[model samples]
Target: MKRKINCETARNFSIVKALEKLGHFPKKSNEKEAWFLSPFRSETQASFKVSKTKNRWYDHGEGIGGNVIDLVCKVLTCSIKEALSFLNGDTLFFSFQQQQNLLKKETGIDIIKVQEIEHPALIQYLNSRGISVSIANTYCKEVWYLYKASEFFTIGLKNDKGGWELRNKIFKNSSSPKSYTYIQNNNKQLIILEGMFDLLSFAIMEDVLLNTSDILVLNSISFIKDIEKFIHKYIIVHLYLDNDSAGKKATQYLMNKYEHVIDKSSSYRNYKDLNDVLSYENRKEI
Candidate 1:
């Protein structure tokens, strides 16, 4: 059995080493202290610091500081018990890696062309995700884009801002000016979804040859606040979110803020989301 280490012992553990283990190397360092980029938020300058001698850490941006345990809690966003278990090797913690932000990438995607969905590879990709070619053709387009001077293509779903959400077998990205996608059908009842694929999956599952209600694809949960203006008038709002903590929290937030908000995630509670269930069911049939 793994042994438990108390807070005092965990505190004395080298903060510099712990930060390094979490894939956060110091930008500047001396014998007494080291400065690092804040893991909590992205910035060009290093504002997070670890004291080598005192064995403590601080984030200038957040104005928070504490021992290694506190640092772990902040980094993992977990409780003390969870952090202790994580540090004890009882739970595996994946080292955090900085992801390239599509909105802020230096070599932003340049759309070379946009046309009908005809790529065999893209059709296979959609089929792999249990999305039929007819559904994809109806809702998406084939987009050829240039990134880092290399040509690439993917399935594109257009948003309200004219930007495209790009997805393929390997990479998922979006053009700048990202925003949600809404399809209004003059219906009082609205269906809300996290992504376009979820709506397509729901259509396939329900055999929705004709859309009976208005559709709103948030595209990203960050755009959830923007929904208030569009959703306030709807008599009933159906939420089809992922079966995850963030999804559940967003579901609750909408339910608390609006009337006739129904969570339909229970239909796919055993899976991650609507598309996940569709993919799994497709796999089961084969």
Candidate 2:
């Protein structure tokens, strides 16, 4: 019989331990809260706070708060079942029934195979995505046979699970599937984009303008709720959302809520998005 999953076991999974593994040692701790750098965004201040006593979290910067499981779910971007399985150590190995037929399917061997950096297939995949091998090398790495019997690959980032965050890769056409990307600079100024392409396009434009401002890709417009608090914390925020109806709605909603925040992209009313205008004007300089 299949074993039943346990929630208590999953809840016992330590948020503190996981954050430590992510290289975020809590800077402040009392009986109730533990403060640390925002794990979702690059920031100098400690805005991501965990409530040790209540086993909850509140990211003052992003304004997202929930229980430990919520943090795990957001960080790993996995479903509840997957998160529980991960905590139960089921992710690392297969069951006995699988072991019986493992050799016939080569499942055991594939599971143990180590991913190489210069794999031909991986290199080709990256190139096909309109991303350079060097860029992929800098931001990501290939994983071998991580999933089941298949040779799965993923991009490496600071976050533990190396799955593709779907942020700025040209190969990832739409942000529908949901991915995460973070952009920041020394300056207090910050900008958030709705998609990976938008972020890349913004980065290119920022480079041309010699602007040192920070940028972030929400990967999905829905993540707007996730980072609403972070937006308020910043002294100056430029909303460069897409000019589509949904984007317009989101922009208007935020503007009405936060009058002080600037909507920079409102100036580009003619273009559907920053990328469209950049591409339209023959602005290859970006």
- Candidate that scores best on TM-score: 1
Per-residue C-alpha lDDT of model 2 across residues 128-173, encoded as one tens digit per residue: 3344456445444553333344443333332222223422211121
Predicted candidate 1 versus true structure: per-residue lDDT over 1-286, tens digit per residue = 6558777677777888766545466778999999986655433457788889888888875577989888877766567876676566555432212211223333467899999888887888788789988888777899987656667777888999998876765334467667888988898888998887887897898755228888888877667778879888788899998776557888999999887899988889898789989999899988
The TM-scores of all predictions, comma-separated, are: 0.65, 0.44
Q: Number of clashes in every candidate structure? A: 0, 3
Over all chains combined, what TM-score does candidate 2 have? 0.44
Task: Report lDDT per candidate.
Answer: 0.75, 0.54
